[model samples]
Every structure is written in C-alpha cells, then in structure tokens.
Target: MPSLTAACATPGMRRLRILPACLHEYRGFSALRPWRRPDAVLGWGRKPTALKARRFAARHAIPYVALEDGFLRSWGLGVDGHQPHSLVVDHRGIYYDATRPSDLERLIHAAPFAAEELARARRCMALIREYRLSKYNHAPARALPAGDRPRVLVVDQTAGDASIEFGLAAAATFEAMLQAALAEHPEADILVKVHPDVVAGKKRGHLLEAARHHPRCRLVGEALAPWSLLDAVDSVHVVTSQLGFEALLAGRRVVCHGMPFYAGWGLTDDRLTCPRRGRPRRLEEVFAAAYLRYCRYANPYTGEPSTLEATIDLIADQKRRHAQLAGDWVGIGFSSWKRRFVGDFLGARARLQHVARPDDAPPTAGIRRLVWSSHHQALEALERQPPAAPLWRMEDGFIRSVGLGVDLVRPLSLIIDASGIHYDPRRASDLERLLNDTTFSPHLLDRARRLRQRIVSAGLNKYNVGTPAAGLDLPEQHRILLVVGQVESDASVRCAAPEIATNAELLRRVRAAHPEAYILYKPHPDVVSGARLGQLDTEARRLYNRLITDISITALLERVDDVHTMSSLAGFEALLRGRRVTAWGTPFYAGWGLTRDHGRHCPRRARRLTLDELVAGCLILYPTYLDPRSRRLINVETAVGLLEQQRRTTRALPLPQRLYRGYRHLFIERH
Candidate 1:
C-alpha cells in the first residue's frame, strides 16, 4: 500500500528496484524492505528502458523479467481505463520476440503439464468455445458463406505491428500473403479480415484498394472479433499473427506463411521454419503452457487478481450487456436533462431522439420509445396510436438511494426495458416475467449470490450518496421499525400503493401496527430536495421517535429490525443488505417469496426464489447501466463498484447552486 517515493533512492537517482505495485490501481501490496530487494525485475516488453533496466539489474546481480499481454482482452478500446486480463512476466527474457530461447519457448518445450492443469486448460477452452469469446467480444456482421465453396480467411495485421516487426513478417508481407491465398485457393472464397486497429483508424493495413475490387476476394473492413470471423471460414492464412494460433484452437486448417510463435509445433501447416520448436505439441499442452502457467488475470471491475474462468464469465456478461444496450435507437417522450442518464446507459450506438410531442415522432424502424408512466399525455398517445417501435418504460432502479442535497444529483443507475416498468400494475415487467418464468440455474444463482455478497460487503447503495450514520442512543428494549416515505405523486405509489396514498398515511399505518415499537421515519430524497411533494409538518413528524435525514440508507438498514414501505426501492436495497422487508404494495421484489407481501401477489410467482435469483433478475438482467462519468455502457458489477467510489468521494454543490437546482426541480414538478 506504500506510495512510490523519491526518498527510496538518493536525490535525482532512479528507483533502485521496482516496487511490486499492482498493474491496476484498485489493488495493492505492502512495501518490501530496502535490504530485501527482489531477485528479479519484470517488464511488459523489450522497450529501450526495459533493456536498460535489465542492464542495471544485471549490474546489481539481480535477475530481470520481461512481460506482455495474454489473450482475451475486453470489448472496450484499451486507449482509456481498460487493462489487460493476462500478462506474462519472464525471467529468461521477453516472451513474444525473444532473440535466443525465450522463457515461453523453454516452458512450452520443457514444462510438464499436470493432470489438474490439463483439466483447467480443457475447462477454459470449453467456456471460450461455448461463449464464443475472443480477445474482443464483438461478433462479425458478415454472414457465413453458404454451400461451402471452401472459404479462406487471410488475417491482416497493422503495418509495422510488433508481431510482424519481431517475427518473420514485414510491411509488404500482408499483401504477399493475400496474393498467395488467392493463387492457392483460386476456386475458394477469400476474405481479408483486417485487424481492429486498422478498422478503428488507429493504424493502416496493406491491401485495401486492390483487395476490394478482386473478383473472388472481398475486403472486410469491420472490427469484428477474430473468434467470430474464424467460425465462417474453413482455413486461416497468417504471417506470425495470433489468429493463426487461435485458428488451431478452433480446429480449422491453418497455413502459416511465416515462422509465427505457434508454427513448427505440428499443430499448424508451416511454410516457414522455427527449428528450435521441432518437438510436437498437443493443442491442450500448448494452451496449458501459454495460458495457465504464463499468465495472470485480474477482475475487470474490482481490479483484484482473478481466475481465468471467473474472468471469462465476467467478459461474457459484459459483452451481453453491451450488445443489449446497443440494440436500437431510443426515442424519449417528455424528456429532461436527467433523461441523458437513460440515454447514456443505452450508449452511443443507440442514438437518443427527443420527442416533445406525439407529432414529433421519427423513423420507427428498430426504434424504441422511452415513456415515463407518469406522463399521461405521452402514455395515452402511445396507447391510442401505437408506434411500430417497442415500448421501453423508464424509471429509477432499486439502489436509487442517493440525491445531492440539491435537486441536481445525477443518478447512479436507471432502468429502461421493453417490458412494463417495475412500479406500474398495468402490464407485466421483465422482472415479473423472469420471476415467473425462470428455472434458476445453479451456476448463475451462485454468481448472483457472490455478487450480492460483494455489494453488501462494500456497503454500496444505489446512488452511492455519501452519508454517515447518526450516532443514536436508543432504549435497549425497544424494537426498531424503519418506515420509508415516498412521493405520493410517484408512479409506484399511485399505481401500486392502494391502501397508503400518502407519506402520512404510511406512517399512520406503521405506527398503528406497532404502537410500542420505536419508529424511524425517512422522507424520500426527492421530497427532501424539494423536487417533489410529501414532507410531514412538525406535528406529523413529532408522531415518530425520530425523523432521519442525514443518515445513509445502508446505515439505517443495519440498525433497523425491518423496513416498512409503500413500494419504494429502499425496501429492495434493504432486502439485498439482509434486512427484513414488509411490503405494503406489490413492488417487483415482492411476491417472489422473498419479502413479506401484504398486497396483491401474482399466482404465476408461486416458485420459491433465492436472494441471487432476485438479484440476477432485478440488478443484472432487468436494467441497463452506464458509467455516468464516462457516459458509456457498463456491466452491473462495474456500475456498483463505480457508485461506491463515487459515494465516498463526491462533494455537494454550493448554497447558490443548490438553491438554483432546487428551484428548477420545483418548477418542473409544478408544471
């Protein structure tokens, strides 16, 4: 946990030894003693400084280690915050382009694969195959060639890339490979798949103009994932590209025109030679050496060290979330600035179209309309003249426990889906459907349970609004009941809370039910910020033992025996934290055999559900999430982690700004 310090060395001198700092910022290790320096030093690649560091370490009689990324990266561009899932740290030399018998070559040749190691390799490979996972999780848009004319995929790498520069390929090698493929597979359908960097305009490739016009050859410019591209092709042609190795993994015939890392291993058809790797290797043996032994993985969300299996599952989940978010363009009715939060979650691929009125509708092909159920005009118009686009009812998510002291608080998350909104009783929602229809898989249930544990342990709330617990001195014998208040005008209360119409009525009911219990009343954040109505007067407030405001929902949940609510998300958040929840209305979390439901229960929801099933449906499956700061789509786990970080560090607005935002909210509500 020690910060890198100049004091570790003499003034203006370089760091004598590299500290064992985590490649990711979220992880940490205690500082090593000055006298007990590392036996070796590690570098990602053979950069100039790395060589110099090696020299320096050698002079000090310390071994030097070089490093590089392993396979299976991420869906995002690595230009920003994304880090690699795997890295190779070698004491013999750099792995990718070692001059003479690198550590990887030694390991692949001499290392023995234990039975358990082989089993792990098999498991990893199976998961990759089942998920269709690749370095990048994107799938190709190109359709598979029908009738099987023997398709050959010629993989193109960025010109002057490390693999080409270090291995047997050059700048003109890609063009030469393309021509060779065309000549050899004259009757075959030849498709040239470009590297991701080329498609993203980060780098250029060799054969675009000529390859596009060839009669039998087609140039694919899209940045589709290589694994998906490999599925449609019968054979792969590469010059020292990783796709050649991946081709062997996919069980496709591979033709390596140059001496790539995987060539000469008897697994590939090599046109070139690597005499050092003369020994034959099974695919699993090669896999075990390259992946299981040589690489280390870290959790994408928490940045803690992780297993390859867990990492694969997370990547699959993230990729699925990304695709769902980008499904279609979204048109929102009666929009506000906060609607940007919803739009952000949908991501850049899904364009946001503002519809001020019904007449302002745009093209409806593959379009989705987001309607707030409270807006009667927009809702009625949609019902009367239904658009071709699907309906995505939008609302706040369960962990929406935070708001700025002012009304300008940005949400940590929002829910937008094709099914009915969670609060509305007019139609069935995605959550209701999943609860009714899903036969829980043990693996998914286990994942959900682990996720729930992390959320609870981290003390993460919906908005991650930072509020400390109140230091309360309670009568030891009194039973504590937390009464959650909500906006009476809110859709959830109006449509679901038939018995308790107002905050006062909710309080009255809780008090009447437990006359001897100590009652703690908490007004909704919206009401407290003056963005909406429903705050109690002094006399009404006096009915409760204490009116809590300055405490966080997490803190309240810990102290209370149970929570009483008229269909507020606070009840759901409390449930996640292991608090007893008594639902006065049929909120989405109720009727699932989890909460104590006093309202209507659907007959379809007769199946007993676990905490993970509820979490999987509500948090992971039901809602789409975006990192508000980055305005990009993210997975549920990442959303929770980011919210927790934001909660701890976020600062409130100044008095003037707070007053202005409060006024704005009040104006909007009054209108």
Candidate 2:
C-alpha cells in the first residue's frame, strides 16, 4: 500500500472523485423525481440511483468513485443527501462490494500506524461509543424489549439495496441470516431489528409475516437508533449493514453473514470472506485508516472541514437540544402575540397551550407544566387553585433588540424558569441569585469571558437592526452620551422605574444633568416601527443634539463614551463594550457596583461583578435562545454565530411579508 497522503497527492487521484457527490435531500412532493446527472457516479449498488450512475459513468468514460459513511454520521436523517459528517470515499471501488479489492482493505492490511495515529483512533472510538453516536445520532424509537435472557439482534437491510446485492449476492440472505440466528441461538431472545427505511416506507425489507410470529422471535419494528440497538444486544447478526461496523466499534460480538468491509477482517465472526483481505487487523488500525485517514467531514454548523472531536461535541450538543425540545409541553395561560413567538422559538420541544383567558383550563391530555407572565390575569386565576403541574415564569432577554424599523418582532432570546423573572422586584429572580452568588465555577467565568469577546467583536446586539453608524459626527470638545429610550408601557419600566414614567421625562432629566454633553437619543424599535407608544413630538425632538433612529445599537455603542438608560438592555450592551453606564432605573444589571444607579438596588447584589459573571448569569445561564433557522435551543456561542450570520445576511422584509406585518401590527395594537 502507498502512503495515504501520496495517494491523495497523485495527479490521477484528483480525477479519482467520489460520486452522487452528496445524498439528495428529500423535499417531499417536489423532490420525487428520477436521479439526474450527479457530480460523479456512485458504483455497484442495486438502488436505482447507484445502478444508473454506474452505467452512465462506464458508458461515457466519466470518472466515478464509491464511498461509505464513516463511523460518526449525523444527528438527523442519514440518507437522501442530508449530508454525512464523515464518509469513506473509495477510489478503487465501493468498499462493501466484495467483488473487488478496495482501497480500505489494502489500507487496513498495509497502512502503517504511528503511535500518535493509534492514540487518536482510540480517542475517536471512545467518543463514538460514549455518546452512542452513529451515522445518525437519534434516540431509540422504543425501549429495549423486556427479557432477562441473553439477546441476539438480527439486523435487517433494505431489499434490493446496494449492500444486499453486492455483499450478500442473494436476495433471500436476510431471511437466511434470521433463521440461522434463531436456529443457532434458540434459547436466546431473538430481536429482529427492522431497517429504518422500511419503517419509514421509503424501502422494502425481507421480514416475513410468519417469521415475526415465531415464539422466540420479537420483530423489533421500532425505528430505534442503530447504536441503541447495538448497545443492548450481546451479539449482532447482519447481512452487510453499517450497524455491524458500529457493533464492532462498541466491542459487541459481530457475526456477519455476508462480506461487509469489516466482516473479512479477523475481528468479526464471518460466514463469508474476501480472499484478498488476508491480513488480520485490529480495531484501532481499521478505525485509524477508515476514520482519521480516509474520511472527509464538514462541520454541520460552519460547513468547514472539521475534526472528529469537534463533530462529536456538536452532535452531543444537538442531542441535548433535541431532548430539551422533546420535554413536556407547558400550558401558558392567557394569549399574547409573544406567546406564538415563544412557541416558535422553543420549536417542537415543549408544547404551548395558549389559554385565551384565565377561566380556560389547559388541555388535560398532555398538560404537565405551566408557564405565565408575572402580571398576566392567568397568574391570579392559578393562584386561586393551583394545578398539579409545576409553574415557570417567562420573560424577555436583555439583548432582545432586532425588530426596530419594521412592525415585526421576535424574542430571539427568552428566559423560562421556576424562579421569578429578571425585571420583577417582589421576589428574587434566577439572574439576581446567580449574580449574588460567589461560587460559580472558574470554567463558567472563562466561558463568559470568551463569549463576551465574541459578542463584542462580532458587533451583535439584540436587534442587529440599523445601517452603518460610520458617518455620524461627534463634536470634538464634548463627551458624547447616548440616552436610550424604551417602550413607556413595557412591564420592565413599569416595575423597575417607577420614577421615570415616560421617554420624554427620562430624556428631560438626562439632558438637564448632562447639559454640556453631546446627547444622542435613540427611540426603541417598537416606537420607531409604530407598533407601540413613546413617539416624540416635534418640540420634544429638539432636546438632543441628534435623534438617532437608523444606526445599529452596536455601532452607536462604539461611538458613544457613556450610556444612560432606565432599564434598557443597551446599558448592558454598552457595559460589554467597556463604556461607562448610568442607570436611571434599578434594572437587573444595576447595583452590582457596575453602574451609577439612581432608583433601586438589590441589597443581595453587593458583589462587584466582572463582565463575564454578568454575562454568564444573564446571557448563558438564564436565557433560552433559539436558533432562528433550526428553531432549537442553542448555546450562547452558537447563538452568537447564528446572530452574526443574521447580521451579515439580514435583508429588508419582502413586500408581501411587510404588508402582512402591517395587518398583524394593527391587530396587536388594538388588542
């Protein structure tokens, strides 16, 4: 065998490209069509796509290569071009098609493993097993069947698929293997795991009705994740499925009835053999060649070439997020437009029961949790007779800033917890508790610091609205102070700033105090978009040097030396940018010795806080941010990435959408 690097560097290697370059995505009715020309052809498979590409390549002398998805695939649907995180592109031939000597077999036999390569392979293998990750990292469809007896899982494959035709060489092979498993291990609990495609109605399988009812047999029809099945069973019986490879990865006994690439290797109990694969190999050697050396991976988040460790971390994070999305639905009492936003942001994970009024009981069928606003009428009704389900308080995030110029708005960030909300003055909020506590982990602080740097550098704010703040002029001799305004009727101002009732009164006070300073007043997005109150009259507009409405909050923060706000998150954003902040109201971010507070301060928050600590509590710990695209709960780091992408890619709303928004705005204002 040649050096893998040398093989890749070969001029001919450039032409030795893999085909059906990617799996085609399933878009339902629109996607149901015959396979068109692919970038190259995938070979030796009985599937229509594979057979067509194979013939076309041969007929036209087009270079074609065959490949298999490597160990860690993805957390979503694997086939149909959803994109695999890892794959084994074979130039010689498809690795599973036992008729030919493939590059994988040659590499397994002859590729020299340095100590570093072996160590890395071991680490990669450990992560795969630990996470129970696979080509698609999904939770099992059903629990493992209840039986104390030793279990033997007979993995089924799609009939007429590539693996069945090329490796098994017989159509009836799956049935033969199932019968053999039951005959050999008669006392064992024989669980025949059905193919996912078969369960999805996308493909056919070989499971007979008669075999399913056999006393020892329990046809495992659930779309259980492959890894979950592999982990539960003592041994795996297969006629060439990726599950056999995964079973080997998990150190389970693998009995291959047909020649999979992993089968001919001495580690597995093989009923079929590849004569060319004569050299016996260890798991790490095979893994190192197939995964670390052979496969190509693109990070699902960034679409850049990724390391196995990074991909594993990402998959694990997504899995947790998916689990979060699947949690019990919360019956939110009383209706607000924001409730719809909450449901959309939370995605399909938690169910939202939008009760039209306090008298409306939540749907009894699936209601186990309750969430409501602090001042909502439903809160009073629930207090009269508390339900069995736990209650959580929901509120907006500090950086909830983007939908300013238009009537449209979304809570890109929100908080939901058992503790009181951030703006509430009556009870201690979760954020206040975090801020006052001194025992936060060093790792949490470090993460906050990194997040702060990322947030600042990316120029991301709640709204990410507005154009360049570039040309706005500041007089050379005076200090520039930004006066941030908020919705006069918003709950935060009503609760936190009792003294400063209106934007005009707040502006008058700020202007009188900083008479010499260049005051720049920016109205809240809702005000600018005419969705809510706080629009200034012509006489009131002249109180500031300039009334800024078009520039981005981040840009304005960068230009100003100081920011004064009632309880606007702009003060917090300015704090992250190292600007001096003066608070006219006792916002959650105040009284930690971080700002000059005028209204109120929590006696509990006596500790002088770092920006990261503040960030950890406010942004990381407290809020639930949803990815605008995926609509799943994402970490602040991921949120920053998404928001930055949003900032870079955000365009003016479509005319139709804008018109619809106007109608929605009128309805909202009236209500």
* Sliding window of 10 residues with minimal summed lDDT for model 2: 24-33
Q: Please, what are the lDDT tens digits per residue for candidate 1 over residues 1-671?
A: 43322111111112211122223321222222345454444444665545555655667776655656667766565555455555665667555563456777887896468889888898788777766777666553345547458789998776766667667667777778888899988888888887656666778887665567888887777767677678788899998777887788788999987666677778888776776787898888888877777666664444456667776776776677666656665454655765556667665546676767765776565777777656777878876775577777676666553454235566655677677777865578777887778776665677788888888888776655536676765667999989999888877888788777788877787888888999998888767667777878665676689888767777888888989998988888898888899998878788878899887766656778888888988877776666565565556776666666666666765677677766767686678
My TM-score estimates for the predictions, one after another, are 0.80, 0.70
* Residues 76-145, model 2: lDDT tens digits: 6633324456666666776777888777777787756998999989988887777677777665434565
lDDT of 2 at 203: 78
Q: What is the C-alpha RMSD of each candidate to the true structure, in Å?
A: 5.8, 7.6
- As a whole number from 0 to 100, the lDDT of residue 578 in candidate 2 is 97
Whole-model lDDT per candidate: 0.70, 0.70
Note the clash tally of each candidate: 5, 11
lDDT of 2: 0.70
